[model samples]
Target: MASPAPTSAPTTAERIRSACARSGGAMLAVEGLDPTTTPVHHLLDDGSFAITVPCDGSLVATVVSAGNAGVQAVLEMTDYAPLPLREPVRSLVWIQGRLRDVPIGEVPALLDLIASTEPNPALLQVNSGSSQGEGDTRLALMRLEIESVVVADATGAESVALSALLGARPDPFCGMESCWLQHMESAHRDVVDRLAARLPASLRRGRVRPLGLDRYGVQLRVEGADGDHDVRLPFAHPVDDVTGLSQAIRVLMGCPFLNGLRARGA
Candidate 1:
């Protein structure tokens, strides 16, 4: 037998695209305090990325990139506060970079350095022998819920749409299991409403039974002559929220393995 042709290694972009496809859709759970906010969840598609502390009165930076040879990211300083736009006296050359890596404890010095750069006028004045540290520390806390879906088309135009729908990289910490369930309930309600809107006359004529919620999630059973189809919708936010749920419904409706139930009939 002849030797097989060598396989080419996937390019970074190809790897990213494949990861995005595998992700299908995902929700993020984010949390942090003042200046810098760390996205707790690691996105499957991209290596570790983080959101920098707000500067120039903004809460976030537009562009974020992974750290060099590490599971961390550096905030592109220029995006949030450009040098030309800086107010000379107030801006002390704001060159301190923001970086975060997984197993976060590894960079204690870096963390402290970044934390020091936070807008702490009280601390600055106290060190300068001008004021005490009694002034309020302006800390902003928020929980952001993000859902991402990949839309690849032949024309490559869908990438733009997908990016638009997904928006900027979300804080991963936002998609905690508890938060995920909450979002899932919201999604379930939305889906059920859509299905109800397209209810078939025949089914509407039949008895409508309400199924109660359970530990796993909610279930709604509908009886029909062909057979009873139990429509069980899992309320756990899928890896990728929208695409995962959409694919699940499509599978349930299309598969002969599953009871042929038209969740939304034509």
Candidate 2:
């Protein structure tokens, strides 16, 4: 697919964390640190995530440099989501904020709180075979207080306010979007072709493929010599339920012409 232009959404952080929760792990960069990118396990809940890092690592060393070896530091978290098209990169989220560690005594309770929402197996490792303070000495639990979140997708890149991103929720079909898009491209090629017809004649000359589907619309990617261009066909109304979502897509199909014409034999 073509490179995404910058676009803003209030729900950007939720989408970012949702991508993180789904893909697992992100590229963590700490300023003036030896290791440019640290691979840490993060559990995102509420508006922040607790990242478990190596206690003796360069990242930890940097965090402690400010005399508060026991506290937090500023860092960056970048999350990437893969798309179906040739280019593959569908979304990119960059979150910059302060990262602080949780006291050893509170690790279990924090992990439990995270488990209540999404169970990340890595959090379990922190709970086993380690004693109070011992776990803290060997590992660092860092929390990121998001100062800003930037989301880049097909629509483009947009800076999202922390309040807006925190208050919003992910699309209802988020978890199923990937599989459903794959199914559409593989088994429902005819539907894709029909939908492509809805695009202006100028756009029909290029190769059209089902790009993605969300609560708001179906995205179609057109492959041209210049590059891939994405066009979104907005739904009549946003749908949180699968049934309503189906009806919306069917409406896009121009029901009376697509479905009815075929059922005329009945």
Candidate 3:
């Protein structure tokens, strides 16, 4: 994880970039085009992602007729907490854009860009020559030129400017967020139990789960008679490293083992 922005909510660009880094797939919906789901993808530095579809697919045919085929379609990408919790999806980014067919000459450069960043093993299937590659002719790459984006989560929904998303950086923990969070949920039950004891009495009806952890705070989800309620416990200050993160989490959790009693004012 990285430190929160000094003052304002993270730039719309930051959130969008982080969400894209966290997303593996997105739903592509356009009028007169069947929703397409192909995995050979890339999210360029410019805040656009390319999805390869079969040559005969309606999406490509739509593109053949209209240069701005994507202007009316929606490309929805979502990020979910790597671990199980009362609420699994942490954020969603809905991108609306103009879709375009990758020119033949641009495909090589585009594929190179995608390969360098996305290490999806399935990419091994993209062979340009007819010698040994199968399914090459059936595939065509299309790019979504993002015009607008909407990021929604437990925090709420907000529109992010295309420029901001393209300029922002993803969380440092983006790659390992899932693994660490899953470890916390599975290997740290005692810690969760201790944290649960601190929840407001009214919300202790069912279960308490660690919802998320970021430089700014720790989130908890409590299942109650009515439904689930989420609470964010802000750290005293922003944390930029694992040591700081550990100390902050300990302080927030009241350092149960350090003393017989919870810390004062914790």
CA-only RMSD, every prediction:
19.6, 6.6, 5.4
Cα distance off (Å), candidate 1, residue 173: 21
- The true-versus-predicted C-alpha distance at residue 51 of model 3, in Å, is 3.1
RMSD of 3: 5.4
Global CA lDDT of candidate 2, please?
A: 0.66
For residues 1-266, write the lDDT of model 2, one tens digit per residue: 99764332225666665565455556666656553333344535466756776666677666645443333333344333234465666677777777666666888788777678667555555635364444333445667766667878777898877677656666677678778878888888888888998999888988887766777788888987778888888886677798888887888887774423666556
In the range 153-255, model 3's lDDT, one tens digit per residue, is 8768999777776676776556766777678789988877767777778877778777766666676788776877887677777677888778777877777
Tell me model 3's lDDT, rounded to 2 decimals: 0.71
Alpha-carbon error at 67 in model 2, in Å? 5.8
Order by TM-score, highest first: 3, 2, 1
Clashes of each: 14, 6, 5
Better of 2 and 3 by TM-score: 3
lDDT of 1 by residue, 1-266 (tens): 99764322322233233233222122222223233432121222222222222222233222222333222222211111111111111111011122432233433432334345332222222112334346423221112222222232212322222243234343222223234434434555554444433445555443333332222233344456654443444433333354454454444343333334454653
How many clashing pairs in candidate 1?
14
- The better-scoring model by lDDT among 1 and 3 is 3
Best of the two (1, 3) by TM-score: 3
